[model samples]
Target: MSIVFEPVRGRPNSGGRLTVGTLYYGDARYPIRIEDRALAHLKIVILTKLRRNESFALSWEKKPADGSGRGTVWIHPALSFHFEFSGSKEPEINMAWLEKMSESANRTLGLRIDDEPREGEADPAAARAGV
Candidate 1:
């Protein structure tokens, strides 16, 4: 199975920016709110999980404190997937994977494999030299 992210609405606000999105798993739809903190945490978790090749389930309920709506997301850790963040608006958060997600949710969520860094890229000395 795969997951898809589609941005329905995006706007900046006083407290913070809000990303109103839709997550798709088959016929089911899950509304997603990507707060700045939540997005940061999500990126870390995704990258770490990909690095270790460890699979785990991610289940969360979407119950807004403001009472817009409620939904749920069931993510199969082992499944090949990608998360695409797509919309006309720019977000305060910027990350490589997040950028790809915006373009095409399916492409981001279906990532079963990720390439390891090049020989020099992983080396601290080389990285320091800007190689």
Candidate 2:
């Protein structure tokens, strides 16, 4: 007989807690660590535009470890997307921040990830988009 064991997962961090989540891009296996709150906002903006057949660029500043430059991608409706969240509870969506992002998505530069705006309330777009 042989005995095997798997490593434990979902261990909490030391000291200060993290509101962090990882976003894995495609089957290529790129992992992007993002704050849970911001990812929640981004999920809305990214999918909403795709639903309307609007294509745009999505950019995020790479961390120092990732070479400290900005990375971007052309986001089109044809591309496949799946958002996986770690927490069982969904992070609250901030409307003001979403509006800021949506407006930027409509611009020529596409959707550049910016620092979050002041937190606010509900998304009127969700109702209109029939989600």
Candidate 3:
């Protein structure tokens, strides 16, 4: 499946709906409009953390555009289980593409993909087996 990237900005009027700009991927540069409420799963993840009163980091690397540095973002979307980025140090992941990748990862792996690992945890399977 094709991925999409969009620039996100915080809006004052809306409570948590971030504005997006310039969706790019696979010959498509259309506009993207996503509200915080629309990404329900992400919201669930974020709220869970917020309820626990924890802080974390989120990151993604985007494919290079215009031959410059790639897309990436490291932010704390405290209200959701995932995050979005528009810039990256690694060219393979993009902020705009993070949601979809997380969705797919969650679907295939049957687990949550957050920005950081739990304390003392290095692998997903390790937690599953109670290691």
Q: Which model scores highest in TM-score? A: 2
For residues 63-129, write the lDDT of model 2, one tens digit per residue. 6554666666778877677666555567565575678789889999888656654433345475568
For candidate 2, which ten residues in a row score worst on lDDT? 1-10
What is the TM-score of candidate 2? Answer: 0.70
Candidate 3, residue 131: CA error in Å? 16
Q: Evaluate residue 24 in candidate 2 and report its C-alpha lDDT on the 0 to 100 scale.
A: 52
True lDDT of residue 39, candidate 3: 34
Best by lDDT: 2
The TM-score obtained by model 1 is 0.35
Q: List the global CA lDDT of all models.
A: 0.39, 0.62, 0.33
Writing each residue's lDDT as its tens digit, candidate 3 over 23-93 gives 22223232222232223334344445456664443233332552334232222333222243332221222
Lowest lDDT sum, 10 consecutive residues, model 1, at 111-120
- Root-mean-square deviation (CA) per prediction: 11.6, 10.3, 15.0
lDDT, model 3, position 27: 30
Greater TM-score among 1 and 2 belongs to: 2
Model 1 agreement with the true structure over 41-130: per-residue lDDT tens digits:
355555566567654434433334444333334345554444334344434443433433322223433322122223233444445688
